[model samples]
Target: MIQVLRPARFTELTGEDEDIPRPPLSQTRTAQQSRRRKQKKQLERRWRHSAVVAALTPAQAAAVATTHADATSALDLLTFLSRERSHEYSPDTFATLALRLVEARRCPADVGRARVHMIRACRTPLEMTRAMDDLDTLARRGPRMDLMAYGALLVQLNTLGMIDVTRARQLRQASTVHPPILVFLATGLVGSQVRWGSGAPLPQGIDLFFLSHPILSTLASSDRLLPRSPAHARHLFDGMPRRKKRQSAPPVSIADRIGTLPDSLLHHVLSFLPVQAVVRTCVLARRWRHLWRSTTSLRIVGLDDNYYVDVEELRKFVDHFLILRERTDLDLVEIKFNEFCEEDQPYVKTWVRFALMCKVRRLTFHVRGSQYLYLDPHLVSRHLRTLDLDGVGLPETFLDFGSCPVLEDLKISHCIINACRILSHSLKHLSIYCCHNEFNCRIHVSTPCLVSLKLDHFIGRTPLLENMALLESADVYLSDYCKDVCLNYDSGVLCGSNNNACQNCVPIEDDCSRECVLLGGISNAKYLKLLPGSKTFVFTRDLKHCPTFIKLKTLLLNEYWCEAPDLDPLACILKNSPVLEKLTLQLFSEGPNHKVEIKGRYSSMERPSAISEHLNIVEVKCSVVDERILKVLKFLSALNICFIF
Candidate 1:
């Protein structure tokens, strides 16, 4: 009786039985659970409904509906839909979807597919009618519609090859939407039979208008809307009546018509010609006499053996050019001379002075002289934002860019700067290439704003680059003869067992140790050039204490050796670079045989075991096909490489 008093019946279970009453359902919890279940059911229902609706499409509609929303999927779908009949879908839906697809970019495949679909989707007469309506809507909006977008649509329509005359006429008229429209139209017109006759041709001034418009000029030659026949097109252009001449025109002879062109247009045309041609054209007429002086940029490039020109003539030409530009601020001036004589020094100095006076924005001087020439420090350090000097000698007096203030870039190659303390507070870029001399040159750059520094062929035992807080990227190439080393010899800790100069010297205060990169051993040869040759070489290794470049992303190692000393240094670099993405190695050899030897060494070094762990992408280009090339391929393959040959 104690255990089996039957669980109380409903009548006996009233109110409170001995057993704890089941807890009353909490209203809040019950309501929340109900809501969640309801929401889930609604989602499932909606998804099912969408699937059913998609399955009801015609053959074309089915293809489009099944088209992957992504680029690849869209492309595949479009290709399939192109061959299908247009009667399979509602024209309105097709046009709407096509427009939407075209507007998206992530789905390039999809856009391409939609384009093909739109082209083939218009096979039906009804579809074509709908497309024309769509075009009309687009046209009515005028400038609201992007000219490029509209033109692209029209091009797609034309490419379908099924457009009727009326549609073609609409397409042709669309060209007037913008100047770029003309290019697409012109492209379509080529090998095309569409005609909008009896209508007056576009105004003759259109060509002149396009000449001044960057976008229009870019598309003028390939205008598909323009007539294809060059002669007919010329006639059409010429047929348009010219503006009436003023009765009171400036007093000018008919012989001067050649020079009567507007200075701006003349300059534009001349800009496309070679510098030599530009000089020759200056002799055309009085109006053209000062034309070359008006050039904003000048580049003097030497040809093969003809690169050598008479120094006197070159100096005279520069002198004349500078005098003519006395009043105007030259934007860019470049001078390349194969050789400079003592007599030419005065003229070169004058040119530099004038450039500084005019506040030249960009200046480049490449002069090859036997003896070092002293360049005025003041002229060398001017308002120049960009300066590139190659093979020019620097004065003994260290160049002090007393706050080049605005100098952003400085590049010097094959130049001798004897113990210069370069001080440019605003210098953002510094590149120096020293070849064939360990001139004991010490560069002390105190540029807090420097962002990039590149040093090549440095032979100094101690190269100092201090206090560049903003430095971000650096490219350094050391020579083999000069061990890559850094020293605090001021405190005196002589490094390298090979150097017995200070064997038992007391440690100096700033006794910084020199880090050397040795590349003489055969094991280190793998890291050396893939090709070998008796090419001119420079050896120096004084660049070791340069600041870390945290923002460096692309690194190009022109000629690198993988010696034991270089391993730890390179590892340190890789450890510091957290965002490096691309690495390119360029190798060159003096001769074919030398290239083979270098390539063989490169092959051995490029083995899978030799690749750095941090490398994500590697590109190796070897001029000669040898074992080195094969090794690189294998190395890259082990990493599942994306290689280009």
Candidate 2:
């Protein structure tokens, strides 16, 4: 029901006088005023939260934000939060909240509000059909959210001048009694005339708001006789740019309620789906045919999150996605393989490169099967800030971190690092869990800006760390798989016997050197936990030259620190830490059969200043009550400070 492009008198259309002046430009707060108010509100927010923030240490603050951002009250974080203390949540509000949310962006619920307004403005089916077409034309410009702010179009700010003149005429006619772009231009939106010009959808992200001010409405066409787009640019004005007229939009079904949604919103909804499913949407309607190609977020999984991905289909999709799609910024990209053969590693690597090439800010790569996706030197992205890798392999070259300059947090689990050195200048936090190496090389890490480090249950040689001046908290665990076994061959040779001495049967830290590597690097941490494996002696070896932990306030050690022979390691650390206040020991002691006593051993170990002066609390957890357990109780009794079991 495309309305004929003809002159329709406003007076005749709605039985009213045609002398009505163009509605005064809709007024709103200015950007500068809005900014000032926004700043003022921000200051107020800071003031309100300042006390709680001041009470938190940096580590606690980071933890709280990480753990609380997804709490129930954070639901409003996805959209503009209600500023009013007594805001009403009407029944209709629930409809908008029903939209699926991708982590980075949300499918706006208000997308159809303006369309509904247009429908309401229409007096008949003819007008309704014409209005729908006008919406198509309005969308020819990208589905820019600024235009769709709060579900309303910002017509006054349109530089393309491609208004729905047809709808404008209807609104003008309706306004005679009540109210209402293509000849129905979006005049009512910004209170400015939509100049007749090119149709190629407006470019995405166009908001030279200053240049497209409502004051530029003086350039509107004189009457309702719908004008075709201009031939070419003569002299350019603020109202019109030199864009060629876009072809008339594909016909939209007059009955389409959901199709009328802005593409930006639709794409957001589609982002929650894997690309395989996004491709299926093209068959739904003509408008959706090319929509999949423009989506900014990508999830390269099987058809769904519970993926049933086929290799050949994924291959075809990968090629189609990269080749057919227009270049755009990726907010978040994830590639998770539930199950795939080892041969697909190359394809997975290629997919990772594609995500990186799009400048993704957040990426998650998981190869969930027995296979691991080997990271390459080309894993670069200036925009990459957070990366989560599971079941992946890191090559020696990949550890340099020259690729991702802005990478801040990296969490790797169930992975293998075949690297000797791990260095990153921009990384703030690094966590590696259940990861191991192929050989006996001790990984060396030099991250001067690191704030938090966690190496839990990692295997292979104990890592040698340095240059961690900014470290605040560390949790290092030496699992049974760790190559730090010490079999005392003979006391005379320290860790060896005669020529055949192999007392140091495993990968123990070199005690021959005075430069403390592992313990010294993390000495600045305020909170430290060192959990050693049942027989691993890496902590003991490092204890020989452990650096003074000047900032330590809390420490947690394991049973090995007080093994029957000596409590020297515990004494050494306690002596080094001046401000230490709390100590916790978790023991899995053997029963009474093991000869354990502090009577002789405690006297041999010199008392650390922290124990006599600063130490306030001690906690001990035991596997069983035995002679060894009694010895630990004896030691706690001597501390005088209260002890918790």
lDDT of 2 at 344: 66
TM-scores of all predicted structures: 0.42, 0.53
lDDT of 1 at 375: 71
- The numbered model that scores best in lDDT is 2
Worst 10 residues of 1 by lDDT: 517-526
Regions of model 2 farther than 4 Å from truth: 1-272, 278-292, 303-313, 338-345, 487-514, 589-614
Instruction: Name the Cα RMSD for model 1.
Output: 28.9
**Candidate 2 lDDT, 194-238, residue by residue in tens:** 342423223332223212322222233333332223321212233
**Tens-digit lDDT track of model 1 for 1-645:** 111222222112111233423233455656745653564344334434453323323543334443434333223222333333223444454445555555542223333334334434565555665666664443332222244444445454445543344543543344324433445445344323323242434333332333433334444444443565545454545665889877874865567665778877776676554356677876776788878756656555443324655456566555444433314455666666666677777767766766665678898887665555557755454567998888766664535666466888889888767644667777888887773333543345566677777766655533455655565566555543332332322211224323543432222324223422211111111122211111211112222432343455555543332222323333444444445555555534333234332211112235453334445656554467655456444544554355544
